[model samples]
Target: MDFRFSPSDDAFRRDARAWLDAHPPAEATPRQWERTLGADGWIGLGWGRTPYGNRTATLTQQVVWAEEYARTPHTPPRLGHIGENLLAPTLLAHGTAAQKDQFLPPIARGEAIWCQGYSEPGAGSDLAAIRTTATRTTATRTTATRTPSARTTSPRTPATYRVTGQKIWTSHAHEADWCFVLARTEAGSHRHHGLSLLLVPMDQPDGSVEVRPIRQLTGTSEFNEVFFDGARAHPDHVVGGEGNGWRVAMDLLAAERGVSTLAQQIGFGEELERVLEEARDTADPLLRDRLVRQWAELRTMRWNALRTLGGGPDPAAPSVAKLLWGGWHQRLGELAMAVRGVAATAGPYDWTESEPYELDAAQRLFLFSRADTIYGGSDEIQRTIIAERVLGLPREARGQ
Candidate 1:
C-alpha cells in the first residue's frame, strides 16, 4: 500500500501547520484552546459533513492534521480528545440518530469534556467482568397483590437508569462534564451479556457522583477513581441499544487504536529524539545498538499503522497495534533510564524535605511508561484476543 501523502494532503498539512503556529498554546488556557479549535472546525476532522459543524477531512487529511498537531512544540495535551477521538467515532458508528444529534455538536464545539468509565477495580482489561450496575427505573411505582386491599399505584414518568457502582483508573474523570459508562443493565447478567453503554451526566445535583484523583508515580493525578451512587441516565441515553453494549464497547476500543495511533507514533518519535540526544556520548556499543533499533522499530510501527488505514474493522488490527506500541513505549522508557544511568534514580528535590516533589522528564517517562503494557487492555489480554479470535485457537479455561 502506498503511504505517501498526495499533493492535496501536503496542502492540508501546510494549512494545519500554519493555524497551529499562529495559535501557540501559551496564548490561551487549555479549555479556551479547545474552544478555539472547535470554532475553527478543527476538532472532528475525520467525521464527514454532518450537522455537527465539524470540518470534514479525508483519511489522509486526518492523518496530516494529527501529525501536524503532534509535531507542533508546546501544544498542550488536548482536553477534548476523549470526546473527539474516542466517543465521537463510537457514536458515529453505533449511536442512534438522536444520540448523534445531541452529543456531537458540543464535542465539535469543544464545550463538553468527556472521560471513559470502562475500568473497574476487578475488571480492568477483562471488561466483560465489570460489576457496575445500571438498573432501569421510573419516577412512579406500582404494586399489586392478589388481595384487593394490597393494590397500589402512582403516576408514571419517563424511565431512567439508576447507576450504582465504582470505576477505577478513570482518566480525567474529575474534569469531564460527562462519562460513557459500561454497566450491566440486566439483573443477574454475567460476562458480556446484558451490558449497556450509558451516556451519563457527571454533574449530579444529589451528590450521587464523586471523583477522587489517584496520584501517580509521575506525581500527576490524571487517573481517578469515580463512585456512582444512584446517578441517573435517561433511558434514551443507552447507546447501541440496551443489551448490546459489549459490541459497542468493542467498536470504541477499535476506534481507540485507529487513526489515533498514527498521531501517537509522532509523539513517540519526539520522545525517541530526546532519548537519542541523551545517548549521543554513550560508550556502550550495546546501548547504541538498542537506540538504533528503537528508531527503526518506530518507523516500522508508523508504516504498519498507515497500511491498515481505511481497512474495514478487522478484529486483529487493533490487538496488533496495541501490542506493537505498548511494548515499544515501555522499552523506550527503560532505554531512557538506562541512558540517564544513576542520575535517573533521583528526583531534583531534597528527599529529607516533607514537601511534595516532582519527577524529572526522564524519571516521569520511565515511571509512567511502566503502565503502558498494563492499561488500555494489557499485553496478555491482547495476545489472548489474537489467539482465540484471529488465529482460531482453543479458548482458555475460566474459573466460575
Candidate 2:
C-alpha cells in the first residue's frame, strides 16, 4: 500500500503549517484555548464528522495533524473522555440529520462539552446491570426512575429510562453541557439485550441537574458522582433503535477505542520526549535503553493508529495498542524517576515550579499511567481480546 501522502495532501500540510504560523499560540492562559480552538476549529485533533474531512481522509493526514499538534508548545483543551470518545461519534453515527447538524457543529467548534453517564455505584465493568430507568411520557419526553439495582436485570417501565440512578466516577460532569447516558429499557434475563443510550442536557438554568465533583488524588475532582432524580430527556434522545443500546454502546466503544488511540499515542510520545530532554543526563544506560525502547514502541503505536484511521476498522488491534501504551508509559515513568535520583520525588524546581507545565512530567506520567491499563479495559482484558480474536486461542470462562 502507498503510505506516502499524495501531492494534494502535501499541499494541505503546507497550508496547515502556514495557518499555525499566522495564529501562533496565545500567551494569556485564557486566550490560549480560544486561539487554538479558532485555529484548529475542533476541540480535538482527531476523529470528527469532518466538514473538511471524512472517514476517507488519508491516515497520513491524521498522523500529520496529531504529530504537529503534539509538537506545538501550545496547550490543547483538556477534553473529557466522554466528549471525545463516546458522545461525538455516537451522535454522528446514529443521530438524526437535524441532531447531527445541531450538535456536531458546536462540538467541532468547541462550543459545547459533553460527559458520559454510563457507570453507576453497582454497575461498572458489568455495565449491563445498570438501573437508571427512563419511562416515556409523550413522544418527546420521558422521566428517570433510579433505585439501586441488586439484581442484574431489574425491569421498570417501557419506553426507555426516566433516569433516576446515581452515576459515580463520571469524569467532568460538572463542566459538561451534555451527557450521553446508557439506561435500562427492558425487563428479562439480565441479558446484554436490554439497554439503551440516551443523550441528556445537563447544567440547565432551572437547577434540574445537580453535579457534585468527587475529589481525586490530583486535588482535582476530574471525576464526579452525579445523582439524577426525576431527570427528564426527550424520547428522541435515544441513539439507535429501542432495546439496541447494548449493541450501540459496543459500537460506540469500538469507535472510542479506535479514535482515542491516535491522540493518546501522541500524548504519550510527547511525555516520553520530555523525559528524554529533562532526565537524560541523569538517566543510566539501562534506563536510557528502556526509554529508547518505549520511544520505538510508541512510534509503532502511532503507525498502527494511523493504519486504523486510514484502513477499515480492526477490533482487536486497539486493545493491543492500549495495553502496550499503558505499560510503556508506566515503565518510562518509573525509569525517569530512577534516573532523576534524589530529585525524583522533589517538587517543582525554583525555576519551573511556578509554571503549570508538568513539573517532572515523568512523575506525573508515572502516577497517571496506573489508570491507563484500568480505564479502557485492563491489560488483562486486552490480553484476552488478543488471545481470543487475534491469536485464535480458546476463550476464557466468563459467565456470558
- Give the top-scoring candidate (lDDT): 1
lDDT values for all models: 0.91, 0.67
Regions of candidate 2 where Cα sits further than 4 Å from its true position? 24-57, 78-85, 138-161, 188-191, 204-208, 348-360, 388-400
* Residues 88-193 of candidate 2: C-alpha lDDT, one tens digit per residue: 6777678787677667666655556788888888777567678887665533334455668643433454443466677878877877789888887675536476
TM-score of decoy 1: 0.94
lDDT of 1 at 259: 80
Lowest lDDT block of 10, candidate 1: 141-150
Q: For this target, which candidate reaches the highest TM-score against the unseen true structure? A: 1
For model 2, the local distance difference test gives 0.67
- Kindly report which residue stretches of model 1 are placed more than 4 angstroms away from their true locations once superposed: 141-157, 310-312
- Report the lDDT of model 2 for residue 237: 78
Give all TM-scores, in the order shown.
0.94, 0.79
